[model samples]
Target: MAIILAITNSKGGVGKTTTCANLGAALSAAGKAVLLVDNDPQGDLTKVMRSDPKSLKYTLANLMNAVLDDTEPELFVNRAVIEGAGIHYIPANSKLAGVSSRLVALQMSSRYRGGETGGTPCELVMARVLELFQSQYDYILIDCGHSMDLLTINALAAAHQAIVPVQAHYLAMEDMADTLEVIQTIRQGINPKLAVGGILLTMYQGRTNLCRGIQDEIQADYGNAFTVFSSPIDFSIRVAEHPIGAASIFAYEPNNPAAKAYSAVAQEVLSYGQK
Candidate 1:
């Protein structure tokens, strides 16, 4: 079985998508089979993976709708793009926005119908679809949008673990609780096996007092309650300079500080399986 992970944060600009792509790339470089799922309507992950979301013939939305419509999802499994980066992925597009809206409508209808009419609860749609391809990879990293809508809920419901990436800033640190609360809620009701993989501090500047202060504060606040990765991804222009469909950071610039940082984090993540 794959270790399905959701890279989620309710706050945008927190490097959620970047972390999703880089971490999956790091894992793939370490010889792990990785499948990246673009759960956001923005398709940033898809774009980063070197595919045009709008031009793709199939997507995460199509697969989810198929699961709900009782169509065989296996047909879509083979369509995962085997990018040059060595990470396979399912892309998403603006159509995912429609799927998100439909999930909400389904939830409302299910409430009124007492859950008798819906085939799958809105929160479990992604779970149902991911189950079809879980065993094919060692890790499935889901890049969730910056909202706690049904789409995020579905991602949480499907995930075995969550990697909450927060920018290394005081204001961004404040939003950690909200993201963790969502994970706790999902664990309580939807997916009991779900756990926090760790809290990753991104865009970190080690020399800056502000970033360092916030990092220490986050460690103090969440260290006991959750795992705060010892390695923080350094802020770098190279990270943002990765062109579409380029091999991961390791492939883009193997010696970049951010790449080294992500490689360390991947080791930490791999340690979890040992424990």
Candidate 2:
């Protein structure tokens, strides 16, 4: 079975998609079969993986439609996956924005018709779709949209764990309490098996005292609840340019500090899985 992990944060520009792309690449480089799922409507992860969302004939939206129709998941799972950068992924585009509304309509219709115990709700659809691929990959990484919407909740419901990438700044650290509360709520109500993989510090600058202070504060506040990774992703121009080159940091510049840092974090993740 795959260990499904969601890379998510409520705030944008915190490197959630970047971490998902690099971590999937690094894990694949370690000889693990990886599937990166773009759960965000923005399609940033899809573009970074060298896929053009506009040209894709099939996408995650199609799979969600099939799930809503109660079709066999196996019949449509492979058709939505695009292979690139040593991993398989289901791309998402703006069309995915309608899925949540459709799911809500389905629930309403079920209530009116008294059909089949309301079927599967919107929040559990992603979990059902991912169940089809549990044995096919070693890791399934979901790159979530930067919000606490139905889509993000579906990702959380489907995941075995979550990796929160927080920028090393005072404001970002202050917003983390709410994000952790949401995760805790999901674990309690939807997925009891969901664990916090770790808290990763991104866009870190060692030269800045403010960055160091925020890192120390995060450890002191949440270290008992979740593991805070020691290897912080440093600020790098190469990382920003990775998507344009259609590659991960490990592939774009193997010797880069950000690449090495992600590799170390991947090893830490592997060790956690072993335990």
Candidate 3:
């Protein structure tokens, strides 16, 4: 079965996209067939995959648009094959940002919306993707946009797990409650198999009491949500300036402590649902 994880943090700059890309890379490197779904409308993950989408043929937006056509769903998805890394990426674009409103527009114009058994069109798009593509991947990692809107809901509905990346900042911690509430609601109704994959503490420093305090508070609230996540991503320029398609910390500096941390988390995720 494909292990689908939605990498999201309601707060931005918390390493969600980085985690998704790198985890996809790491898992693919470990001989797993990984499919990375760039669900972020910002197109950051897509930029990371293609470095530049200007030259790409079809993006996630196109794929979603093609859902209405009579074609194999994968035909619409861009299968970006990274050399030596058994990975596939379904790239997104800035155009994806308007998807929600367009979907809402669909609701207002379609008779389906007025029906008794009507449902959100956004929710169905990803379910179709999963039914068609999940079998081809050992892991499908969805890199969500920075909001709990329709796209995130669609991603959450299609995935089995969610990995929330949080930074060691006071304000960032506040968003955790709302995000978790959304997760709880999704789990209760939409996707019963969904669970908190883990809470990753990013931008951390062991020397700060602030880091420890935040970790403690989170654990207190969610019962030690992170079992094997890394300490902090640290203040590294390399992490920020890496070229598109370049390997993340795992490939750039696998020996680094931060890389080791992400690898540990990757290992934990790999062990999920195992006997």
Query: Whose TM-score is greatest here?
Result: 1
Error of 1 at 52 (Å): 1.1
Error of 2 at 167 (Å): 0.5
Worst 10 residues of 3 by lDDT: 76-85
Angstrom error at residue 58, model 2: 0.7
Each model's number of backbone clashes?
1, 0, 0
Writing each residue's lDDT as its tens digit, candidate 3 over 40-112 gives 7777877776546556556677666655343565765445333333567777667676666665566565646
The number of clashing residue pairs in model 1 is: 1
List candidate 1 stretches off by more than 4 Å: 80-83, 244-247
In Å, residue 144's CA in model 1 sits off its true spot by: 0.5
Model 3: residues with Cα > 4 Å off, grouped in runs = 68-74, 77-85, 107-120, 224-232, 243-245
C-alpha RMSD values across all candidates? 1.3, 1.9, 2.8
Instruction: Compute each candidate's TM-score over C-alphas.
Output: 0.96, 0.94, 0.88
Model 3 local distance difference test score: 0.73
Q: What is the C-alpha lDDT of each candidate?
A: 0.88, 0.88, 0.73
Task: Estimate, for each residue in 1-275, the C-alpha lDDT of model 1 and write its tens digit.
Answer: 99999999999999898999899989998999999999999999888888878898888888888777778877877675445457788899998998998888888888899877647778899998888877788999999999999999999999988999989888886678899998999999989999999999999999999999998998888899889999999999889777644746786688999999999999999999898
What is the TM-score (0 to 1) of candidate 3? 0.88
